[model samples]
Target: MGEVVFWTIIRTAIVLPLLWVLKSYLNVDLWWTVSIISVYGVIIHPAVIHYRLFNEKNEEIIEDTLCSTCEHFDKTAVLCLKHDEHPTRDYLPCDGIDWSPKSSDKSQNVFDE
Candidate 1:
């Protein structure tokens, strides 16, 4: 996830200057249209695909592993906050000793309710 955000920033950093340079040559309306499409095609699309791939790769770990249910588990990063370790389908930071329910139904979900 961090990598996705990192690369998105990198892409934005690259494309933004090119968009500026293109603006000097193209008509304003067409430049804006092209800028939007180029940003989406080059930056947003890859980040989204990378995110999907990252999610797909971690699917089993997220859904089946003991860390998946643990309070210390961070599903976004697949990390154990207390142990500062990444949990996988086969490896648990606490070896199941620290497993607990992830209370998404608590305060964070209050707005939804």
Candidate 2:
């Protein structure tokens, strides 16, 4: 996720200045169309593709691990907040000794009543 965001920032930084330089040469209507297409093609599309790939690569770790249900787990980074380590299918940062349910789960039980 961070990688996706970082590269998108890099692409935007590069594309915006180039677009500004092209503005003077192209007619207003043509420039607008080009800007829209370039922004989508260069910036948005690649980000979406990279994000999907990231998710696909991390799918098992995200969905099947004990960290998925733990309070210290950070799904966005797939990190264990308490141990400051990444969790995998066969490995747990705390080895189940320090595991705790997410607060949202408790909240849901209360809300149901």
Candidate 3:
């Protein structure tokens, strides 16, 4: 996720200046069209693709692993917050000794009710 955002920022940093330079050469209507297309093609599209790939690669670790249900697990980063380590399907940072179940919103709501 951080990698996706980092690369998107890098692409924006690169593309924006080029678009600014092109604005001076092209007419208003053409520049608007080109800028929109360029922004989507260069920045948005690649970011979406990279995010999808990142999710695909981490799907198992995020969904099926024991760490996924732990209170310290961060689904977005697939990291154990307590241990400050990334967990894989085969590896756990705390080795189950420190594992704790994630608190459920539904259970909280029921108790409140």
lDDT of 3 at 50: 98
TM-score of each: 0.86, 0.89, 0.91
The alpha-carbon RMSD values of the candidates against the true structure, listed in the order shown, are 4.6, 2.1, 2.7
Cα lDDT of model 1 by residue, 1-113, tens digit: 88999999999999999999999999999999999999999999999999999999999988888787778888899899989999877788788888766787355667667
> On residues 1-113, what C-alpha lDDT tens digit does candidate 2 reach at each position?
78899999999999999999999999999999999999999999999999999889888988887888889988888889999988888899799999888899878878999
Each prediction's Cα lDDT score? 0.88, 0.91, 0.92
Sort by TM-score, best first: what order?
Answer: 3, 2, 1
Clashes per model (N, Cα, C within 3 A)? 0, 0, 0
Q: Please give, for residues 1-113, the per-residue lDDT of candidate 3 as tens digits.
A: 88999999999999999999999999999999999999999999999999999999999999998888788999887789999999998999899989877789447767899
Q: How does candidate 2 score on lDDT?
A: 0.91
The alpha-carbon lDDT assigned to residue 113 of candidate 3 equals 100
Q: Which pairs in model 3 have colliding backbones? A: none
